[model samples]
Target: MEIFWRIFDTLILAGGFVYIFIRYGIPFFDNRKKGIELSLKKAAEYEKEAEKLYEQAMDVLKEVKSEVENIKKEALKETETERNNIIKDAETAAEKISGNYINQAKSEIDKQKKQLFDEALNMSFKFMQDIMQREMTSEVYGKINDSFLKLQEEAFDRRSNK
Candidate 1:
């Protein structure tokens, strides 16, 4: 039993020395541990930096989207305003044209009416003069005056009867 225990202790010590040399490097175990720990710390710091950059990029993208939306809305409003202005201008122009046409038509009608009245007055005067000249013999002229007086007297009598 003692011999078996002595061999086990020797094997355990040799295995421990081999494991330490492989894990911590052959030169200095503490130096190897510090180098590994520093490398891990640097890796963690770089990961955190990459995460911060990603967040900043996402924020910038969101801001750009918001600005684009605002520009689109402004453009739509401008287009609508322009459309309304054009419609109003067209309506005003149409109304003005219609009013001018109405005035011109009224003027033409008044001018035609005046011309018709003048022609009628001229015809009436010419016919009256022709009739007077045809009846200008002294005896016929005296008889026309007597007949006109008699006609007036009959009209006055008819109105009194009514």
Candidate 2:
């Protein structure tokens, strides 16, 4: 009979302990599970946002790279245009200088030719007067002088007209 009472007391004590665990411990564990689930959901949302931000960053990088290439091409084109303009301007200046030099040279040659012709004509007239004074009589000399003067006047008129 003592052994049977001992066994019955042990059974009651075990049943009370099991009731307390079911009432309190199960709710505590259930709340902890709900919190863990909420934390996991929030972590998943954060991961998705991170991926979206990464994609946007990559897109922006691509646009910036494209713009840089376009700027380089535009700079090269502008440089080429400026170089061509400089070359064209230099050529035009060279042509203008050459033309001026040519015109000046022609003018100088024409002036020299006219001065040389005038000197030759004056020397020939002096030579003819010396010959006539040495070789002719006064009557022949006077007639030759009048004829020579008329010819000289006609030549001078022709030269002035030209």
Question: Candidate 2 at 134: error in angstroms?
Answer: 2.9
Q: Give the Å shift of residue 29 in candidate 1.
A: 16
- Compute the lDDT of residue 82 as modeled in candidate 2: 99
lDDT, residue 86, model 1:
99
Error of 2 at 114 (Å): 1.6
lDDT assessment of candidate 2? 0.94
Give the clashing pairs for model 1: none
Q: Quick one: RMSD of model 2?
A: 7.8
Model 2: ten consecutive residues of lowest lDDT: 132-141
Q: Quickly count the clashes in candidate 2.
A: 0
Off by over 4 Å in 1: 1-47, 134-136
For residues 104-149, what per-residue lDDT tens digits would candidate 2 score against the true structure?
A: 9999999999999999999999999899778899888789899999
Task: Report the lDDT of model 1 for residue 27.
Answer: 56
Clashes found in each candidate (C-alpha, N, C closer than 3 A): 0, 0
